[model samples]
Target: MINANKTLSLAIMSGKGGVGKTNLSLNLSYALNTGGNSLLLMDCDLGLANLDVLLGISPESNMQDLLTSGAKPSDIVIPIEQGKKFDILPAASGVPELVEMDEDMQDLLFSKITELVGGYQYLVLDLGAGINGTVLSFAAMTQMRIVVITPEPTSLTDSYALIKVLHSQHNVSDFNIVVNQATNEKEARETFNRLNMACEKFLNIKLKNMGYVRYDPAVTEAVRRQIPFIKYAPKSEASRDILNIAVKIQKIRMENMGRLSERPVMKKFPTLDD
Candidate 1:
């Protein structure tokens, strides 16, 4: 289904690697796609992309192909299935220069993205770690930004650092936090609250608690089996948590749309009641 005015681009980011960024992106995209929303899960990790690996397919060409050869967005799209839900998009292989694509290439990337967005309700960009050019650019370009962090002290500190970088470099004030790999609901809530507190106190920015994912062995098994954990173990804790996260995201988008609908439009009176 094509929608010219309904695309919501969300960039998934992390302060550091090994924080389950790719896994969250995959599962969340799958869960969001469940309600008949056209989703495009792009591996904007640029160099060292692995979303395709999680989905169990190696594309002949990826984002690099579209960037260099003028390939259409549809040319490299790959489908992924998580039980009954699915989405499609181009993956990024370990291309050395993509992490630092030049301004010309960046413009081309955005142009291609515009073409792809016409058909997707949501475009989930799975970005790489840190505040490098790649991650920062994706975060800046996307309409929604979700930062993934765990309960570890280092993770919290680095997440703050990431927020500081985005605010300083890109002027991105709004952010959402996802507490990944939490042990329990209480732990997740506490972790998210602490981070939100820190952001409010220090950065003067309000960070929304997007949702959390519980730690589960099925995550590793799914990685080993080259499938999303939600599909690999639907009844697992992680899968259920991801489903809940998706619901929260849906509600947020719906609320945002509702607010837009409430806006007053300036109407022009007909000249002569034609």
Candidate 2:
């Protein structure tokens, strides 16, 4: 069991839009939560929030309600598989305004979120594609930023653009990459090598490999069913790979925090001392 205080925030990003970023986010979260730490998978894709669809849950209230109105985090939080222990806070309900949150609003949300962070060990923020002002700001703010990409040249090119913005604009050197939709292990390694080489040559940033997920038909079927691949096909190839990724992330977290006793857990609102 995780201690009920510490929190870790991970922003899940992608170079291109349809590279299975949400799939990886949700499944890895489920895997991590299985290890005893409470997980809050925040759908940070403000404009096109579909994390709920992926989890097969339609949220009644989301972050948008809290941001536009004066709703508290607890009021908007939707419990997914309540007894299972992991929860998700969907983005604003209904059509997204896409108005671009102002600096004042950003500051207000950040302050409130800090209080909410105390309830969970990990807050996995699934950011949208492209390096817009908002995405870059959130990426720079987080302790860890994961850039997801496929093996396509176009995908790698866009990823470079993202890494450039992060380095030049945010001065963020902490980056990790996960190769999705790879044909096999060899393809995944080659893809990581291509991107890793470029970052070293031009940006002077060394990217860490967080492992890869092979292309699996079960993943597509799970999407069709509007459920996480991990839950839909626990014995499938992708599910096994997701379990590995989860283990790797847990190891990295332990290494970063220098603690192996237990992970952190988010608790009830207002009761958090930190």
Candidate 3:
């Protein structure tokens, strides 16, 4: 179980699109909420938002309404289900300004979001693919960062690049790795090892392996049906792997609870109390 005193914020990101980063974020969130812990899944994909689409929901208001119309954060949050303690702060798609929001706009969003932080134990941000200034800033704000990758040459190269930028520019050294679409456990380890080797040698960073999710047809069906794979096929291989990963991550969070200090590097994203 997570500590209630503070929210364990995690930013799930990727180097490129089409790597199942968003899907992993959605399902991982559901898995983490199994202990009746409340979580707020924020779609920080900005200009290309789509968490609402995957959940088969269309909210009346979103982050846009809060920033532009002075809407309350409570009014914009959409509960994933009536009884489940899960909610998502969906973002607007095709919004140009949202892609590269000015520092004032970011501060406004962060301030508004901080108002509701006390109500949830988790704040899971599904960031847009690739590394932009917005992506780096949001990724740094979170206590944990999970980089999703597949067993592809491009994925390895691009993911390394993303990690490099964060570590070199933003001073974000710690990162978690999630291997997606692996055919088997051996394949998954090989993928992680190859990426780890590159990082260890060149970037001088060690990535915590959060385990892997094998390719499963159930995932495709779940997406097609606009539902999470964990809900769609609870007994599936992919679902099992994700739940296991969630357990691993929970253990990590518990161990690091005492050291979950706020990154004081980004002056623009300071806490309201700061």
Candidate 4:
């Protein structure tokens, strides 16, 4: 169990699917856990839950069970790394009802999440891709929102669209950008700069570059083997990049702690009225 002080909530989202969002979320959680933080990784992709598939763990129950059956959050949490560092709340894949939740359901879901995350140092939500209502609600509530994108023009455009929605509708200003599957640091920086310029010019939002992950074949191999790349290939270029980003995240948390004596007030989950 983590300290009872306060847990930092982070939502990792993408503008579109197949941008390696789930892969990055899993590896980043592992890296943060290995670096001595207790984390709860929630697979918020209600329609397609792949975190359990990536880890080769078949969960008996998931967020769907919790929402539909009134199951306790503790009942669905699966421990990882010998139950020492990380826990995962898997989602029910291909469940249409879990995709677009109504107001009451959303409130019930986040209430359970708040209860479950109390003992965690960090709660990492791997939200579904795109700018759906559920995704926007989770992103708006989190203390840190990370938007993952690639060098593809469509990826950049969709990411900007998501950011714009969050800014205009949800009043979210701060965002952390991660460039994934880049060939080199230069490519990653170029991608971030392009997105940053657009966001600044139109939305007037500044996106902090959270660094990038290099394109590594080992990542594909690890995915094929259903193992997290950080553990499967600790020395791989992609794993190294993830670790660097984890370090930056830890530093950001420490800096935020210094500035705020009390726990930051998280935005409430959006209701139907919202």
Question: TM-score of each candidate?
Answer: 0.89, 0.90, 0.93, 0.94
Count backbone overlaps in model 4.
0
Residue lDDT tens for model 3, 66-185: 999999999998888667779899999999899998778988888777758657777899999998888988987777789999999999888999999998997777888999999999
Q: Which wins on lDDT, candidate 3 or candidate 4?
A: 4
lDDT for every model? 0.78, 0.79, 0.85, 0.87
Q: What are the per-residue Cα lDDT tens digits for candidate 1 across 87-179?
A: 556556657899887767777787766756656667788888888886777687666788999999888988999999888887778888999
Query: Cα lDDT for residue 261, model 4?
Result: 26
TM-score of candidate 3 against the unseen true structure: 0.93
Worst 10 residues of 4 by lDDT: 265-274
Report the error of model 2 at residue 229, Å. Answer: 0.6
